[model samples]
Target chain A: MSNTATDSSETTARHNEKMKRIKAARDKMMAGKTEEKGLIIVHTGTGKGKSSSGFGMIMRCIAWGMPCAVVQFIKGTWETGEKRLLQAHFAGECRFFVSGEGFTWETQDRDRDVAAARNGWEIAKQQILDPRIRFVLLDEINIALRYDYLDIDEVVDFLLTQKPPMTHVCLTGRNARPELIEAADLVTEMSLLKHPFRDGVKAQKGVEF
Target chain B: MSNTATDSSETTARHNEKMKRIKAARDKMMAGKTEEKGLIIVHTGTGKGKSSSGFGMIMRCIAWGMPCAVVQFIKGTWETGEKRLLQAHFAGECRFFVSGEGFTWETQDRDRDVAAARNGWEIAKQQILDPRIRFVLLDEINIALRYDYLDIDEVVDFLLTQKPPMTHVCLTGRNARPELIEAADLVTEMSLLKHPFRDGVKAQKGVEF
Candidate 1:
């Protein structure tokens, strides 16, 4: 028992020493990261949580009393949990625009899709430029871009140049345009290692929405 | 002029037909997904937004009027935007716990780290088993598990067997144990494609925190 205790003690000391070194390195690294600027953030890939993340950031923004806007390019009239929250709870605080009534299901009009995309883009442009809004989430605008409904160069140019210095814009969807990715300050690809839908499990409430 | 109109009409018709076929396939596929169960969700990768995604999910849970709990296992006592939000806005609605005071810099006590992990685990157990708490987030618990501060099998067994049927648990961090991933119903790997930190931009407030 005494030997076992001694052995554990020695292990603890080694672990402590190792941890100290890591902490030192991390602190030094953190010290160098001193500059801050508005970031063009992108969340993309064939996985869940792309839009969920953008929605989450809005909560962070709300927590900080920062004015944020969400422009839903695809899930237009779909009763999303976030939409309900924004409507019922944060109506005055956050600006929300549901531009697309939804794709293909409601109408197979490509022109209509294009028009909705443009409408969403218009709102996004205003929010991105508006210094009042610190953060703007362009939810699923990438899908519209993917289908060639919006001009990639125009959107990228506007986001890169016209966006206010401290205002951040997050675009979430799959197949984010290469131009946007190249222009973004931060890009996260949420890839699906596994999804319940693949195993025939239906989407659940408050989780999928 | 007549030829141009005819060509445009034909293009629109083709697009409509294509969209219809795609929608039909999706509806058929969705029809097979009929079962629902509380999910074991894992957000793990070498990227940002793992915790951000978890934070976002909490907002969704709150929006749905569900009482959720967030047990922060790593960022103990650190001021996070979510923690502030929970305290300031959703105090009663969400239970927030920060377990780790942080690693190494504060204290070089391995035993203390282990104890903190256990302490956090104790809270996690109660929250996971509590039916009132519909959702629980084990933020950065994977790091504790990675350091062997908590037994993986023990943690996994408790999460799998002891968790309430309808309650959901989310584990977030880098390098999640394969056992947890294997058991997870939904796993999204948030990979870093680009980060401003690489360009020497500091972690900004509201966005990072």
Candidate 2:
């Protein structure tokens, strides 16, 4: 019994020492670390989680009292939970723009969808160039371009010409254009390795949404 | 010339009729649908993007073409562009939990944060209770149990209760209770947020990440 106790005590002491070392290292790393300006991140791919990753970053910034905006293309008519929450909690800190009419073919009005897409793009452009809006996300801009709902050259030019000293831009969607990829400082491509749809299972609540 | 034009017109009319009818029906319903699924969603606010409005839903389900597992328990984090896209793309196919992550001091024990806040509830348990993961997102779970590093009752009970119907599970972090949140469908969270340390400026980065 005595030997066992002694051995346990020794282990405890060693563990405590190791923990102290870890804390010291963390403190040291934090000491010199200063916040840099910001980055423009483009998340695109055929896989999943691109937008989720970007939003996770946005949440962190808001926690620290940041300002931001979001402009989406290709969807309208749905009251999303995110929009509700943003309006309720981040009231003055964020702005949102949805396509407001679903897809062009679904609406049977290519002209209307194009008009909404353009409007959404215009909002994104304003935010991208705004000095006050530190972060601007052009969600699904890639899809809009792919569908020819928005002009790619005009969008790319705007992104390239934005004021670089303060603003950070994010673009999320699949089939990102080569031009956009070339212009971005950081680009991530999500690839689909496996998915549940192959098994013929339907979307589930909480898991699929 | 007249004969040729007439023939072409007749052919085009026949081809477009079927497409037009389908498009019209789709447009009418899609234009007035609610984006989010009505279920027990938990967007528990403690992490950075607990309520970035179901980003996980968009990433795992819509973008990746899978089922969904989503619980959002907070109402904020909507500045970035990703949220808009998710709403537009994944409309009417999400479950949400929208409650703030409460407060910091509410859960501060390392162990408690792990077990109860992270893995404590049966919500996460039921979520990952399958081997056919379509998309599982535990939004803002870290802040719920208060940063307790471990909470046996919360974590163990939930894990024990979990029986994944599919395989994909995601856990977002921000003060992630290591023990509890780790036992997730999928786990990821924001590590950095631009803050005032950069010359007393506000948060920046494509609208905060």
Candidate 3:
């Protein structure tokens, strides 16, 4: 029994050494390869900075001379200053698309919301698949998907099928689909610990936007 | 001019309100979005947690049921127990690709080093663009990009074009590309305030993955 135990211990040591050598070799081969890629998703109960998080990424991509597509669902009628700045400064470099119709309950038109969502989804779908467009920000996509304006299964399927290496995609909104979380590479839940709105403070510009 | 000033002040106030409203809406939406979506970039000049920090995020992603891809660039031809554990346990759910080519000058093969680098890049690209991929950890990607083994423009372009509204990408490497630094929505530079490595202690497994 002692001999057998010693034999097993020796075998384990040898096995460990072999594994180390193999890893070293693999690391070498990996270094030989070139290319790096990925995406970002920011959704959580929040004090702030959900869409801003997505937009900040957009600006960063642009500074690197990369093209980006922004698709804002929900707040379609309201004019966001970001849309204006991106258009004027980034002209031809950055593209922004809105739902054209306001929001779900506000409009009280499910058909319009569905139609508007489809419009944004089409743009996002194309950008997600494109190898040339690196940073695709699906601004406020959760509400649309939540309201059943867009099919979750179809969206998830497309995300699963995307190709090319190094493409970065970002989805910012509340109520992200469960399947999306399951399928994501990294997930961050921004649970809102507290907010001023709860204190009856009205929304303010610049600071809030 | 007075009239214009009044209009400007009113517009700014309105802008603040718009920001607040949007933030509130996002918070409300987040209540139902339980799945976490976000990327964690672990970077520091001097610290034991560079890789550890990244691996922590990886562990979190796995717990959430999201698949992960890890590419280690600098630590070539080294035996790491963490790498083995991830490969053995996570196996199908995770991929641990190491560059075996050793350090840049240690091997004295620039051409081969470049080729190995390119290989890592290829793997990274596939992982990053895979929408189903929840997280892609570019371990030491900053080093690769800094060394010019990986093309900066190509990396940025890929980040921009990858599927949007999905995919979370994490870049963990020192001396991150200035452009990449600018492009990151959330950039955290890990400063090496103090480390065992500085005092001549060898790297330990589990502590430095």
User: Which candidate comes out best when scored by DockQ?
Assistant: 1
Total backbone collisions, model 2: 81
Query: lDDT: which is higher, 1 or 2?
Result: 1
Better of 1 and 2 by TM-score: 1
- Residue B76's C-alpha lDDT in candidate 1? 88
DockQ of all candidate complexes: 0.69, 0.11, 0.03
lDDT of 1 by residue, A145-167 (tens): 99878989898999888888888
True contacts kept of each: 0.70, 0.09, 0.00
DockQ of 2: 0.11
Give the CA lDDT, 0 to 100, for residue B182 in model 1: 87
Per-residue lDDT of B190 in model 3: 36
Model 2, span A125-188: residue lDDT tens: 7777777777777777787787666887887787777646566777877888888777765566
Clashes of 3: 56
**TM-score (all chains, Cα) for each model:** 0.95, 0.53, 0.44
Q: Candidate 3, residue A73: CA error in Å? A: 0.9
Second chain TM-score for model 3: 0.75
